[model samples]
Target chain A: MTAEEWEDFRKGHPKAASLKTVPLPFPELCATLFDGNAATGNPSQCLKLQHSAVIRIQTSRTLEEPKEDNMAKFSIATVFIASISLLLTLTHSFSLENPTDRRILVLVDDLALKSSHSIFFSSLQARGFELDFKLSDDPKIALQRYGQHLYDGLILFSPSTERFGGSLDVAAILDFVDSGKDLIVAADANASDLIRNIAAECGIDFDEDPSAVVIDHGSYAVSETEGDHTLIAADDFIQSDVLLGSTKIEAPVLFKGIGHSLNPANSLVLKVLSGSPSAYSANPKSKLSSPPSLSGSSISLVSVVQARNNARIVFSGSLDLFSNKFFKSTVQKAGSSHKFAKSGNQQFATEISKWVFHERGHLKAVNVRHHRVGETDEPAIYRINDDLEYLVEIYEWSGSNWEPYVANDVQVQFYMMSPYVLKTMSNNKKGLYLASFKVPDVYGVFQFKVEYQRLGYTSLSLAKQIPVRPFRHNEYERFIPTAFPYYGASFSTMAGFLIFSFVYLYSK
Target chain B: MGRSPTTKDDAQALFQSLRSAYAATPTNLKIIDLYVVFAVSTAVIQVVYMAIVGSFPFNSFLSGVLSCVGTAVLAVCLRIQVNKENKEFKDLPPERAFADFVLCNLVLHLVIMNFLG
Candidate 1:
């Protein structure tokens, strides 16, 4: 049996997992016990199963088990039952510490999206994610069952869904993100209030006009016929290698959707795809009597937010951006003769989804250690001027494994009420960051702090408290050469007093 | 023109009379006067030395200067009490004043020695 199959069996029958180490010589005997026959102490049942096993082994002697249907079934069942009795263990459900999202729940407005956006879904599936598809109004759907999250991430493709069924609501979804789960939301021109509210909570404000669609006459895609200029060939993507893969996306992504304005107060939100300078959002059918609310390069085509909990969310202005039509379509920007053989939408969607799902840019810091110079063991309290070394190992999740995150700007701060020493750490190219500094002369409770916040990477905020003490009484210098004159003068004064008193009394 | 000669003669006369008056002072009182001058000069010398060299050992510097000043002041008190011309302390014996000065000097020297380091 494969590891995944063994894991599934172990999860399904935890009671039998403990008995796995006790080698089951008779598979038929264990099958009876596992099938709710523990109370039935019948010896004849085991004998009957043993008789069946002998017949199967004799028929499958040539090892061509696939040719015999009954033999294959019996042999596979025996292997599964044997593996199921072997181990009981605990597993994480896509934790941030693990930084790998294994399961996802995709909610759609229509079931036809399973066929329309099959490419994007298939890419996630190919990456080993178990995606559960459900209609937006499916009453039996739930994010968590028995207080345990059923999915590690949520993908909202239902731009027109006004109310989600079951226990999931605006607050429930927000709560899910607060607990460090990932989310991906796609909105169309007729985005309902529910979808808009979710986007607004993520620091993205969709155009207030419900019918408004992003219309760009300057940089619209070059179509065969003169259209309403809603199909935009946007190319302004955020310059980040960690969010977007290292290989550059050469073509402009095709977007046919509404536009949004990121909240200025929200510092965590980033504009992944921005509208062109001439792009504006309004009802394309009506006359432009007033200026559009969101226009110019400020209009965001796609945005992403990384919460303080490290949960990631991506908001796209168009749901059709993930459709097969856009993924397979060729793109040509207006006034540009050069045409891209394929749209950049597929690469853009794949890379950005990798980021939102924590496959990239996820960082973990461990084994934080500090000790006095020339000493291997850490002291409880540091002397005022003792030199010390601060070390921390930081690694980035590379989808399949942790890799060394090499950056020249990682820093460590020796902080009390304020930073006393702020030094940039030097990495050994093996993920170990080192910074050595002398303890400040001032004595108080101090902390070794590392507040690393970089663009497109999970922020690392670590603070380890330490105490600093002044020198002991015996630690002071016994004698100083500089104070010799004062010492001589004082002693001379004592001698002079004794001599003058004797002289005065004897002579007079 | 004759006024210059008169001025020079007047200054000479003043000096002669001051010398005559000081010569009448008792030998013990004169010795105390010399002691006060010696103590005062020593303190001045130490202060000048402190200025030349930085006052790194501040407590030692203070004790050194205070010891000299205390000795000078006690000597002056003894001189005052022993002077028969000064009647304010006539009832107090000169020996008693001498004993008091000795005891005070001993205490001052002990404190200065302790503070020198």
Candidate 2:
């Protein structure tokens, strides 16, 4: 009987039939036998057995009669399911093209803040981030599960929390950043010591006084009731199109919070937004008793740090900058005549978030290659004064896909002790950068180096070592036309010697 | 001021004395002097050529001019040593001096040929 008929008969009379009564179909029998032999000591031996069983099944199928259409449909359905599952597993892993953080954990002081900051959270969600919200003091809160990090980014919004619950602590957060994850911390007036320590670790120091808030008299926002001049309308943003987006911020950002200064010794931290020259950080409720510790343009309202491992962190002095209320608030600078219907808080926060999440300004270089002119194969060592071409393809990760990274200032250096040849590479509109130059006359070990460090983008440093050799003895040109006069002079001297010898001997 | 002869008369007298003195030299020494003059004139011609046409092939220019100058210097040394009246080289034979000059010329020409390119 055909395999299909046997399968139907066995299903219809399961109680009457036994394994001894009927021989099973080849595939089903092999599957059962392989499962019975699962206790094999070596995994490789078990695999061999399974492979042999599959081959036996194929041969048995050829010997048996043809099956019904239902059997083909069943096998096709199983294959389709298996391929879909394989595809799903492949997409779960991290990929180079989509480098933006996927999952983020947001810690807040209370669950009510979730609703208060729903706008920012929704923006992140709209950009395909899976945000996990939890209270800072929750006992079950953990940054990691088992041995793996549960999230690719972290958001600390609980500025007032003195301590965290569970195993989470300052060291744990630093370790998270050390592993190249991103972070965003927002602080306000009376920021807890714990939050201050975190900011200090990132090379920023908040004002010493707990009551100190940023006070800007010259650029304060005009309000219905004039209070402590603490409601700052700050337009002094860092002039970077990559960090702040291409569109100019039309209205001043409304900031009402404390201010901090970047550490002088730390080069990684940068102030994204600064206070006006007249601004100072002091307690506005009390009279001015002494000069404020952080004042003027040095008082940074928003700062960012890019670690050596390329982990990004954004520190904002005020959590209200990201609040729904400030996002909807209208404002006018005290000295300016234009009254913007809405503050620039929404655009500013969104753009900065985009930078911290690595949706912009992430660059990667690939396919670095060098070869002699008019040749396709790369030589082991280059001859001195040989003409060669160097090429590299650079692409920027644009959140969802890798796009061509085009810039005019990228340069390649042929370096040994110092730069022998530094050439600015020309690029095709599609992101292939190339430079052609003759090797220097001197021969030594050399390196092809591209050290690209722009303002907002992650640094791209690539160096490839190559040796350069002097020309061989036979490689020199023999009969040069320019040297004909010298040859003639040398040969004429020899001729003159012969003639002089003959004359001197004959005359004597 | 001291009633010195005119510049033209002085030049003529100097040339006459030099010619008479050179006439006393040996014939072989005179031949060496002629060879020296030829080498020096060739060197001068090459310098003038290098000036008009730029010295682009600098090694060639150097080799050409140096070879001629070297030949002239060697010939002059041979002439000084072979002069029979010179007491300083009375111990050295003229045949030996000529052999030394020939050997030095060969070495100079070999180096010049290598450097010409």
Candidate 3:
């Protein structure tokens, strides 16, 4: 249309006419281009300019492209693929929902341990771990930044680094685990005070003598080159499939380092691997002195602490537990003839890592509902003496799927000052548990409570408070059988009054 | 029996004069007084019965006692208005007083009956 005709159209429909407009020829060309039909007419000067505009854009984008029959693009494509694959591998190393010491930050006093302990480092890498080896004195070994965590797990391999460099210290490590992370701490003959302090906070006390190494003469892994027999073989692990996995350990765990005593006051910590009755912690190289402070079964070879916040920490007296030499070494316990092909380090580390990473011991409760019998909707308030049925569905996270949490000890309480009715709930095997009961006759305020604490599982404490009210004045029973005598007396008195009035009027 | 004849004669004469004065009252007022006495006696009997039986139905006991007491009060009001010797109530007619007494009794009995149960 002509410009004057378009202006006239705009005047007639002002609301629609306010939108932007393009020239007729340009719109016609766009319609043709969108339809994929090239204009057939002689090439106009404007069409040529549009063609050059499209060509200029394409040429500029491909200007840096190598002219090797698309081999350059193939290389770039491979680079993109490799970058994505690397990212996937890195993320798979450390995890939140499942625990693993995959992407570990190995702090060391000297860089020599990287090569000297290459067996340990290589074993870790072979097991799909990305070990970021940093000298303990590195100025950039920060565990967190601005209250945001940087790692899902931490490993302190530096036993003698007196004080960590940068912002990392005892408090930073503790704060990491406090926020529900995993940790593996290994201390040797001369562990730093900072490491000891961290261990003490988790209810473990390393050997007081800075030079003491756990010397087990009676239970050491029998070797041809045995000197002090301090290299012990421990087979007595804590018997728990949930904690250590269902597979039994066939070989004994080899330990050779300082022993620690778990603090009696800390109940959350447990000794997974305990010292044999004959074992004692005293520097074997030094001459005998007074009785050792830590001896006998009180000394824990390897202990684990599952904090109240579900942070899993494994504290080992020996860094050799992670070494490939120990994992692959043949072991024969002292005074025993049965020889094993390999030690228990590999299986023990892998199973414990799965547990610490939240692949186990994670629970979630949902679908909590309560109502009177035969009712679907939960009421805001319940009347005293109401027959109520409370239902709660509890499921545990089985790494990938939710499974029914089953236990006979799960109980429900109808609580007012204390529980008036404590009943063991019955489950339907599908995780839906129901506790049916009559509301107490006494009314004020009441609560439904469930406190489930199992041996190895995380404790579940849940309570829902709901008020119970007495019946209203009109709502009371209109005629109760028990109250019939009282009613009879009232009516008889009125009848007697009527009769007495008649008798008095006539007799007088 | 052993007193002097003159002292005995004086006591007898005093009681005889009091009896004659009471006998001079109107028959309608005397009837009202008899009704009041009946109501009061009924109230006393009920109270004694409640004490022996135990007040398990306390509401019934209250209604029974109040009914008797209310009747006696209404009868007393009737007697006062109808008595010719009472000059202050001379404007009040005996029929009007009886009608008021009957109306008040109706109201009191209604409340007592409701409270009885």
The most accurate candidate by TM-score is 1
| lDDT tens per residue, model 2, A1-508 | 4567556755764532344244333445555667656444444444445446545766877766356466888899999999999767545634565778888989999888899888988999999889999899988888788777878899999999999988889999999999889999999996999999999999999997999999999999999998889999999999998888889998899998999999999999999999999999999999999889999999999999988888899999999999998888998999899999999999999999999989999999999999999998999999999999999999998877889999999999999999999999999979999999999999999999999998889999999999999978667776777667767877787798789889987987
- Each candidate's fnat, in order? 0.35, 0.71, 0.00
Q: What TM-score do all the candidates reach, one by one?
A: 0.75, 0.73, 0.65
User: Which wins on TM-score, candidate 1 or candidate 2?
Assistant: 1
Give the DockQ (C-alpha) for candidate 1.
0.25
TM-score of 2: 0.73
lDDT tens digits, residue span B3-100, model 2: 45687789999999999998987888888888888888888888888888888778788988998899899988888898877899999987799889
Q: TM-score for chain A of every candidate model?
A: 0.80, 0.78, 0.75
Better of 2 and 3 by lDDT: 2
Residues A363-432 of candidate 1 have per-residue lDDT tens digits of 9999999999898898899989999999999999999889988999999999999999999999999999
> Which regions of candidate 3 deviate over 4 angstroms?
A1-133, A497-508, B1-117
* Tens-place lDDT digits, model 1, residues B37-101: 87888788888888988887676678778877887888888888889999999999988988888
Best by DockQ: 2
What is the Cα-based lDDT of residue A260 in candidate 2?
98
lDDT, candidate 1, at A241: 96
The runs of at least 3 residues in candidate 1 whose Cα sits more than 4 Å from the true structure, single-residue gaps closed, are A1-90, A95-97, A497-508, B1-117
